[model samples]
Target: MFLRNQWYVAAWDYEVDRQPIARTICGEPIVLYRRFDRTLVAMRDACPHRLLPLSMGLKEGDNLRCRYHGLLLDSHGTALEMPHGERVTKHLCARTYPIVERHRFAWIWIGDAELADPALIPDFWPCSHPAWRFDGGYYHIKCDYRLAIDNLMDLTHETYVHQGSIGQPEILAAPIDTRVEDESVFVTRWMPDIDPPPFWRDALKRDGRVDRWQICRFIAPSSVIIDVGVAPVEAGATVENHDQGVRGFVIDALTPESATTSHYFWGMARNFDIDDAGFTARFKAQQGGVFLEDVDVLEAQQRSIEANPDMALRVFAIDVGGTRARQVIDKKLKAQGAAAS
Candidate 1:
């Protein structure tokens, strides 16, 4: 089961233009599109009449026209018109979810509409900040959303998985600073004054080793904001000197589609090269490739878990971050369930 009463990424701002697109969030089918005012509208995809998905319809002006029976529905799911039917039922409206469009993403509330508060939405400031150039895409991940959360919380795997790009032996040797707060967790690992990976080395174009950091913040029910970058060894790589080197923020937002599938929205916001289109292209492509590696491993692990349900997982010192994340998620679920009861 998924935690409701939360805002989940429905789609990127540009993905839903005039045409209707269907996406399953939290295992519930819905259709998404933009109104004439460029506002996002999300509603239950199935028509109450014959259970035909409303997404199988056309966008007529500001409303959605159901193709099967010629039913026109507004953004609020109110039935506007019907084919040759004199009696237009007033209460025949499709279920609609609350939508908040900001930070270049469309967020939808999948729970009690009354409890859908915009303040509950997590903030990824760089996505909308002008000083950073942000680029990212969506991935259809065939694994549990929690798997991605765990993978992100414990990034030591990057040492082996990303050897050709961002990985280095220094990562595994570094000690992590893990902290838990109300509804959130932070897993930070700083590798001070080490040889830069090929990606950062080329980007920074520095002559010698540098100090790097991976400060990951995990928000409950699945969202992570990772601040990553490196500075010259002489610059100290601290908060004040971070601007002296190339740095970026990796923002991850996940929406669960099923017990074994999830929708992943991720991107990087870099402050160093705020206006370089070429760098943006390369950054997005290389970053996408890096995430593909993660997806491959996660899918394989999912298959293994399915094959051996009783298989026990061994935890180590490095797993403390992930273990704590899981505990926090479970606690949130328990509290939410009890409140609903």
Candidate 2:
């Protein structure tokens, strides 16, 4: 029930290197590696012979060799060599995924290679901008990808789940503004004349009243870009004031691993303090901690959902953005399903 003809973040550029990295996406096991020229390649994890994971094998030049048997497979998943034989079999070729590395993440197309256009990938350019410094980590969450998407679309949970680090009561009390343009859901909340959240207060040196903005945008399938910052409450939302304040982009790239698990690639991309190495490293570490707080709540919520699969949870007025986001994805899925049929 997931969108197949789309680009999903497979891993950060630095995550995979000489050794093959094994990952499961959309219920299909995949093995990722790099070529001599550093071009990233993704292929079926299971070897065609005996079904041993190719990841368990070693890299042989531009190809991968099966560990169980001396079978060498090329990047295109073609069997190039076999033990005690010098024959290339056509039917034993492994399935390869169309992949492209963009904005520091390797994006893989899950279905229809012909439809996998590089332009279809989401533009998270801010993460790779020269003026911005970005860092994040991946979390293997035990939940449906939609549940994680719902978590990002609704900011109300921050006050409760992330109370220790990035939460404040004013966030929940702030009036929400939801808008949908071109099938993208945008949820904005402006908390004026309130104490800054812990992260912003420390980063921006704002001890008193501050105006904070949590602008969350939900993309198709399951990706989110959260534009957040805080400025002096009296300065208003001017370009100059925002530049003087602390600003950052919370990039959440989500991909479904199975029917009940997800691969969450989250990062913090910021425009300020790029020259300060200590500041950059510390910020990245803190942001990772804050996200783990969310992990706790999301995993707990998933357990509850699994326990009562037949029971429907009640919706609240605050769920407008999350509900709308789900609707847009559902519509896309329906259209894709009909087209395929």
Query: Which RMSD values do the candidates have, in order?
Result: 1.3, 1.7
Winner by lDDT: 1
Q: Write the per-residue lDDT of candidate 1 for residues 99-145, one digit (tens) a residue.
A: 99878789999899999998888888889999988989999999999
- What TM-score does model 1 achieve against the real structure? 0.97
Deviation of model 1 at 230, angstroms: 0.3
Winning model by TM-score: 1
Worst 10 residues of 1 by lDDT: 235-244
For candidate 1, the lDDT comes to 0.88
Q: Estimate each model's TM-score.
A: 0.97, 0.96
Q: Which stretches of candidate 1 lie over 4 Å from their true place?
A: 239-241
Candidate 2 lDDT, 70-184, residue by residue in tens: 7898889998887679677767888999999989899999999999999988879889899888888899999888888888998899888888778888887888989998778
Q: How far is candidate 2 from the true structure (C-alpha RMSD, Å)?
A: 1.7
Give Cα distance to truth, residue 170, candidate 2, Å: 0.8
